[model samples]
Target: MLWVKAFHVIFVISWFAGLCYLPRIFVNLAMEQDGAAYQRLLLMSGKLLRFMSPLSILAVAFGIWTWWFYSFASGPGWHWIHAKLLLVVFLVGYHHVCMRLHKNFVAGRNTKSHTWYRWFNEIPVVLLAGIVILVIVKPF
Candidate 1:
């Protein structure tokens, strides 16, 4: 069971790796106006999305299952769990929005500024920090 946790953590880290790198792709995607380079970035985004889709879902499922398996007795208080859940919800929402944005981006419909995209890139940093703190500190 503990070994299962290691696998879960590995997948979670992989999913976060994809999430972190997606914004860098957005930077490249935003810079391109057209042609083969733009097409290349678009294709990269699609490939990354395909790779991440299942891993991200498995991360969520494994996270929940691990919690239910080990922490079902309720010892560290529900506050920590609640906070973690909220952050997970935010992650899921962000991923969904990113998927929609990627679709629009590939279609060349999104004309967002590089400035906006740069700001958006910071979101995962903050989110990952929050999640890490909740899981690590478990601050009452």
Candidate 2:
């Protein structure tokens, strides 16, 4: 169980690292006027997404293993776990949205400004903070 928790944390951090940076790449892509730079950023984004997708899957898998096999959220008064799970769902949706955004970028149909992406880039940070607080503080 401890090992499961450790791996879960490790993969979660790895996944978050990509989540935090992908949108910053989008910001660069949006702001880039040079065709070469835009293509370079797109290549970077595609590679990052490919790498992060497995991390996200492993993170969620280990998380569910901890919860189901180890009964991490089994007892009463585990409302914080419920809240965290909801946030996790939202985080997954956000990841999907990023994929769609990347597709839009690849299709040369992106209309959002760099400023919008800058704001979008902060989303995972806030979600991470909320998740950590819920897990550590368990403030229901």
Best by TM-score: 2
Model 2, span 84-135: residue lDDT tens:
9989999999999999999999999999999999999999999999999999
**Following a full C-alpha superposition, what root-mean-square deviation does model 2 have from the true structure?**
1.1
The per-candidate count of clashes, in order, stands at 0, 0
TM-score for each candidate, following the candidate numbering? 0.93, 0.96
Instruction: Report lDDT (CA) for all predictions.
Output: 0.85, 0.95
Candidate 1 residue-wise lDDT, 56-114, digit = tens: 89998888888788766366565787788888899988888789989999777987877
Residue 72 in model 1: shift from native, Å? Answer: 3.9
Per-residue error (Å), model 2, residue 107: 0.5
Scored by lDDT, model 2 comes in at: 0.95
TM-score, model 2 to reference: 0.96
Model 1 alpha-carbon miss at residue 52, Å = 0.7
